[model samples]
Target: MLLPGSGSDDRFVRSAFAGPLSAFGITAVTPVPRPGAAVVDGYRAALDAAAAEPGPLVVGGVSLGAHVATAWAVRHCAALGSRLRGVFVALPAWTGPAGAAPAAQAARATAQLVREAGVAGALAQAAAGSPPWLADELGRAWPRYGPGLAPALDAAAVEPAPTADELAGLDVPVGIVALADDPVHPLAVARRWCAALPRAELVISSLAAFGADPELAGRASLLAWLKAGGR
Candidate 1:
């Protein structure tokens, strides 16, 4: 499934994944948030909806959605058992323990930005200064869907970030694609997630590469890994 990056809905994936991933015979499934649906519930339901489609089942998403996809699959995989294929997670947001001065500052700034400007202003500001292809991706995505993102942000941010201990329970095979420069989706957090989860592998990479070449960058590797598991 095409689990999208944060605040992005399926449209974000459409721009990023339509051409590159489909070549692998992968049908990315990006689900819209149901009205009044709890953010987490919507993601959980997205996984269910994707799994129900005729074909093989695998779960994946970008950033917060990526985190949600893996967390949900980790919890449910044993029941589905081996039918659960590997996960392809791109820039999974780091909700883990944070003592970094820079990260702490960025987190506060992000929270305040969203609070003051709503999702649009916050995302627009982030895009303007953001280097590489991600700026283009977020710029296109935020304006079209930013107003509706308040609920999703509220749902993910309301709680204290997910603890590493909590993630340890997720043992299903997972392939994590981590970016180097993203303040929110840091390499440190990706390493932590990989270490915490039992059956997980991580590939360190730059944020620019992920956005610029969806086919050649770590994303391609992620898809290859997921497919190799049992496709």
Candidate 2:
């Protein structure tokens, strides 16, 4: 299963993974989130629901979704054993307490902007500061999330990430893809995850690569998985 970042849906996930993973016969499934729902809890529920589905499953996600996937694995290790094939965590936003992370700070700030200025005005502000492609992406995906986007960002800003010890405890093979220049998803954070996990592979990727090929996220992650010897 593939999970998208905050303000994104299954379409983005599908675009990122479907074509790339298909070559290896991996069918990616991305779920749609209910509007106005709590992001973390909603994704956790989705993860639990996925666990009941038959067949081995590889779980992965981007940004906040990546954090949720790892947190879910830590919370449900017993139930997910063997059935959980591998974990693909891309763009891990934070590592410790929520507010301590740059991404969380940015999320909180963006939430405030959206709340004060509304979506259109917020988009204008974001576009002024962001790369054209990023602004375009947010422009397209943010509206689908509706008014809940801000609150979701706020909730995610404060949501706890798996601790270093918790990360070290994971027994499953893990793959991580980090955009070296994305301060929001710091390469240091990704490196920390790679170092903490007993079994993990880390690949440094770039925004340019994604622009050149949207499927590169999955391709890079799959390579990381193969490097970790995932079947």
lDDT of 1 at 18: 60
What is every candidate's alpha-carbon RMSD to the true fold? Answer: 3.7, 1.4
Tell me the deviation in Å of residue 93 in model 1: 2.1
- What tens digits encode model 2's per-residue C-alpha lDDT throughout 1-231? 788787767777788888878999999888885555477777888887888888888888888788888888877766778877788888898786876688888888989998999888899998898777678788888888789888877887888788889998888888899998887889999999999988899999787876667787888888898788677
Worst 10 residues of 2 by lDDT: 33-42
Q: What tens digits encode model 1's per-residue C-alpha lDDT throughout 26-91?
A: 666678654222766777877887766665676777766666777677667777776777777776
TM-score of each: 0.76, 0.95
- Report lDDT per candidate: 0.63, 0.83
Model 1 TM-score relative to the real fold: 0.76
* Clash totals for all candidate models: 2, 0
Query: How many steric clashes does model 1 contain?
Result: 2
